[model samples]
Target: MDSITQLHATTPEKLTEAILDGVRKEINDLKKEFQPKEPDEFLTRKDTAELLKISLVCLHDWCNKGIIKPYKLGNRTYFSRKELVDNVFNSNL
Candidate 1:
């Protein structure tokens, strides 16, 4: 059983508070379940270059040198923003 299910309160105020708290928690859980998660975003070469504050040539050089991984689909190449953030920030730690 959930914590809310096991709740036992003597005073009316305490009982009311517990019920309200349980309802609130159930609403929050439903909201979390129904809410659509963000899709994985892929940045274009130009977008990635601008994000990194580097020139397009430099970005390509990094990709070629295997410094940063690239995702290629047909004629297009892309980079993951999440991976970039993790790589840049996690390296400092």
Candidate 2:
């Protein structure tokens, strides 16, 4: 069952303000409930190579030649899946 309530406003401006306030509350609630996805997915060197269908040697070479970018943490390297897909789509070949 649903219950309806009436909103009373003295002036048009007050009515507009009340409506805007309700909208703002709804927007705030949505914002609170929203869960944002990760901006980019990180991949390991081997995973990245496998995804690109390239061998480890070739992947390393591409990284060395600046064809593919790599991020290093400690002794490990990572690549952005989004960046790799973008490159594949944008490449001439």
lDDT of each: 0.86, 0.88
- What's the lDDT for residue 74 in model 1? 100
> Can you give the lDDT of residue 70 in candidate 2?
96
**What is candidate 2's lDDT per residue for 16-42, written digit by digit as tens?**
898999999999999888968669989
Model 1, 62: alpha-carbon shift in Å?
1.7
lDDT of 2: 0.88
lDDT of 1 by residue, 43-65 (tens): 99999999889999999898888
The alpha-carbon lDDT assigned to residue 30 of candidate 1 equals 100
Worst 10 residues of 2 by lDDT: 5-14
User: How high is each candidate's TM-score?
Assistant: 0.65, 0.57
Clashing pairs in 1: none
